[model samples]
Target: MRFNKSIISISYMLLFFQISISILGTNNYIVSIPYLKYYFDIIVLFATISCILSFFSQTIAVKELVFIVLWLVVSAITLVTTKDILVVTNALMIISARKFSIKKTVQTVFFANLFSLTTTLILFILGFVSDNNNGTVNKHSFGLSHPNQLGAVLMVLILCSAYLFIHASKNIKFILVILNIFYLLLLNSSGSRGAILASLLMFFVLILFYTKPNYLYSICLLIGVFFFCFSLYSTSTSVYASGSILNKLDTVLTNRVRMNNVFMTNYGIKIFGQQVLYTGGSSIMYHADYAYLDNGYLRNLINFGISYSLLFYIYLISVIRKVNSLNLYSAYIIIIPMLVYGFVEEGFTSFLTNIVLLFTSILFISNEKERE
Candidate 1:
């Protein structure tokens, strides 16, 4: 069988992001990707060049440039004061990597699910040996404790939704949809409320992206679910996501309180360069969730200051609108989940998380003009 160029292109794209992330993600505690903190600029610079080449060659969308500019501005502000610039680089790299089509989009989704499942299985075994003592559900895959990984799950789910809405499929598509849902459930049982919330938000996103009559669409979704569940087997991990859907929902909101306080504080809202002077939380840091922060908006203002924090939000919202205007509902699917979850979790403020979000946003923007 002949391989399609779009498949080849997307494979290359996912490879690029995956490699960069693996090389950088760590638990050293000083900051996940310190290299990203200082030198990720070089990668972004290269990504800028790549996006331009794709645009000129008509291989990607011109709206890609909008993201590049937004990233550059936020990155510059973040670096000038905080001297950290990973998000900028990741954002550009993300933009240049993904320009989704059916085949590659599906591949992207499969690979993401595969990776997530593999990781979950490994952890599950580890938990079994430790008699489930080493890690607990509430703290593991879902919260600020693992935002980066949780963010990845959300990205893949968004990509899957993008594929579903973009193209009409047959019985196989329905099966694939069911599988994705169960796979998502298995991943969630590993215990992450953020992931759960993110998935639900995307369900509605599909509705928003499609401009046609949505009532009739319900039949299509039911078909997809049937196909999805039909493939279940005995070895299939039967562990229901351990707790209530309302399970850790309160813990999520309580943490939001301190985050809110972060924003509510005057120091949190200062413009760029002001962070250099406000050394309050710099010396003191812990897990955003295990710690406590109620106000999401206020958290950024205090932690990174008003300018850097606000720029981050602006970058996110602007990219969403850009994708929506282009009518790439899948990209919208990706962002909506994160937006809803952002209210209860503080990962939105982490340099690592923000960078990941930035990069994913760019991919959707570039994919706006991607063909069927």
Candidate 2:
């Protein structure tokens, strides 16, 4: 069934709000009151439930439905045992894909990020945000808990800006152009090198292919992916090889390479996923029982284990096929930045990534079925 526009709009808006709050750190940015945070969480919960209900109104293959159920069951199991609620919430987003068309989903996400970024800038102007220059070139959190978090949020915004700019009406096109310039500045201020470069590259690729999609677009996407991966590998290798001169670079990652090595050595990979001690020194504490793996791919491996991660990858492959079948190459190109960013950061874990991807995935699935 076609869902009510009002409900879908509210749900998508809340989804982005939920993500903004998640990145903003419930304890610090907007409301420090415990009950207020709980109330917001409840609102987001209800919205997700509404979206899920809408999802089932449409026809779906029995096998596909079964796969979704199994995924939820696995997610619930992981949540109860590991207490990583992101697993369950992320599943909700995946289900959300069916509620709207690709263009609407893209527009919603764009507006959501716009709302988020606007609020953040206002907070920063009012001196409500943190401006801790924790030795980075620009450690402006802009209401987020960390510079990197702001960088990540802006990365998503930048991508959204690029997509919307391409598809926007003449009246809004000028605003988007100006917004793109500002987004780049924000990215720089966030002092996240990986996010900055990856975002720029994604934006550039999307712009290049904005006019039309072609068979060769797949090859172009593969090339983009290769360059991203190589850039990440080269950066990490060079930083480590530089020795003491780039000790700060190592620290910037929170010594993630070392931390990852230690954690793997101590706990090792589990077949079904298990909780371990947090390895970072972040002041904000939520689920203190499990150690934070900043890397999204590794986080999935350690949290969901090989079996579950394999299922997730399979779903991603299907989504890729759907988009490729439709020749929505720009949409396909967008996922590359996040995938590359996930290796060094928590893009896969972050709500910003999930919200954007969920909508895109739904768009692909819907388009694929139409083609058939």
Candidate 3:
């Protein structure tokens, strides 16, 4: 598997920017450097151009083009209805996924995330990033907008780290293990219950699939559904209001669940997605102006509506199936957790989600050739 240097370089650069832009576009930084957020748009543009160049160099699958068109339609709808151009970033990543094999893309993302996490840790140690205290808990934001965001990032890193650990060289394995531990600690510190559980479940499922492939695959699938529901319930405040095991774990989730209900009640299920007229709601803490739908699936419904979002989900699952066919269990380790955590996290709507999607898509197509 000869590596394309240009693709690797651009992919890593794009990923670094995708992960770091949240911190870079922080309120303080935005105030300090007006319009700094727009710089991320330039990064997206560069990534898109790189993908276009790769298209001529590499043979593209019909399936890749189909997904790309679907993503662009999504971006177009988002632009038309919400006037949000950020969807282009997501669209570009879908296209960019064709540039590398699954292994290369996974390794690159693993390293990029490691770099981002390490940078966050250094900044926290240097007092550049605040260690936030939220009444009941002391959480590390690591320069992101919120502790949950940090947890979300750590969740992806944990899965990637686990994959790397399984495949790393003897010398590299120890470091990967150490990084995994660090990621777990940060995830716990961030108090993202959904991500924590999702990561654990992903690792467990992967282990079962690897070790007991014949007996456990069906059982693991059943357990995955149960675990996913339990995780969602654990993260939702309304599900266990009686100060039960759920509340004992975390009360903030009650607020999040309530906010989710509010959106569902207010917006209802629309075939063509409705504009979110109001962003203010009970679950919002830092951003009092906008309502926070903590669930990514629900958020997708709001942004792209039922019909289009369902199309997106179908495309995503097809890619996941492709990865599974290639036996790239690590990509599953990264994506499955993200999908579960997306129930309670908002990464699906952002560039970070698309980055994962990009890699998974590329892995799907690239690995197909290996089979051939």
Candidate 4:
């Protein structure tokens, strides 16, 4: 495939803009820009249409056509039901970049996030951004909307850097140490146990992958399946019941299990997504009530509907199989952590935060020999 410099540059800029806007939107100190979301929606719509045109311009096979049609149907349903354009936009961006290498896609997302995170932290240190701790001394938002947001952003950056470093023939040990140390600091400062645990698990899995590659697949699969099932169980069960194990677990997870149960019981699951009014901890100042379902599995089922959530899980599992078949250990290692993180956070639902979703383009392409 011949490289088109103009197309590549345009796609890169579009991805950077999309990711930057998404990250900046999470910062608490930034004054809400009037009509900014509308502008974003416009750009995303234009970009998706342009990408679809570019994608169809090439000679596509029957298999590709079938997949594309199915994806479009799901995307349309998701957009109409959930009103989430970003999910569709992320997939379209990946489709648009099919002609390019996956490495380029990862690099684009990594740098964009790094830039946003650095800027936010700088402003925070300069006292230009307000640090919201939810009236607690132990937890810090670090300029983002919540303490967990900082941890989530850092986790994304760490995974991206780890993948890049592993593929670039760098000192993996040193990179792992540095990344884990940074994660520990963030954990201590922000009290984001979910992100810290996810990072630690990723680190351990990577080490095992290097030392015992033969058993790594089964281990990862088991961990992912366990988390997925646990998330479902917690969401379905009545976590507030006295003497229930889920109730104890809910306390350990800072009430995430109970919140999931509340939302699931109230809204229930649907085949197509529904509009959910999520009043998170950050909204406490504005509203008397607060409920946030941090579990990604439940969030997807409730927000995007049962069908969309199932499709996403199927896609994720297929990606894992492809990674194993292609011996893409680095990608597999990174994906496992994202899956585990989803058990406690909703970041897995968005491509801007979850790089694994972007890999769908590479894994689904006709040529299976392409290396990242």
For all predicted structures, in order, the TM-scores are: 0.57, 0.80, 0.80, 0.88
Model 3 clash pairs? 237-253, 237-254, 279-290, 279-291
What's the CA RMSD for each of the models? 11.3, 5.0, 4.4, 3.3
- Using TM-score as the measure, the top candidate is 4
Q: Candidate 2 overall Cα lDDT vs. reference?
A: 0.61
Query: 244-347, model 1: which lDDT tens digit per residue?
Result: 32223334443333333332332434565344222214224432324444223444554455565556666555555555455444544444555544554455
- Per-residue alpha-carbon lDDT of candidate 3 for residues 1-372, written as tens digits (9 for 90 to 100): 234556556665666666566444542221255677576676666667766755654566777677677777777776677555656666676667666555656666666666666776676677666655443566756665567667777777777777666767998888877877877887888877777878787677678657864543344344435644554354344544666665444355545555555566566656656577555343353333346676776776765577666766665666665555666555556666666676667676565643456664444454544422
Candidate 2, 6-79: lDDT as tens digits: 55665666665666555444323444555545744663485467456656445676765776687678777777
Q: List the residue pairs that clash in candidate 2.
A: 1-57, 277-291, 278-291
Write down the worst ten-residue block by lDDT for model 1.
231-240
Alpha-carbon runs more than 4 Å astray in model 1: 1-16, 19-70, 94-110, 119-155, 158-168, 207-252, 262-266, 273-289, 292-300, 304-315, 322-324, 346-372
lDDT of 2 at 111: 69
Where in model 2 is the C-alpha error above 4 Å? Answer: 1-7, 23-31, 36-40, 135-137, 207-254, 282-292, 360-372
TM-score of 2: 0.80
Evaluate model 4: give its TM-score.
Answer: 0.88
Instruction: Rank the models by lDDT, top first.
Output: 4, 3, 2, 1
CA deviation > 4 Å runs, candidate 4: 1-6, 30-32, 35-50, 53-58, 169-180, 281-288, 365-372
Candidate scoring better on lDDT of 2 and 4: 4
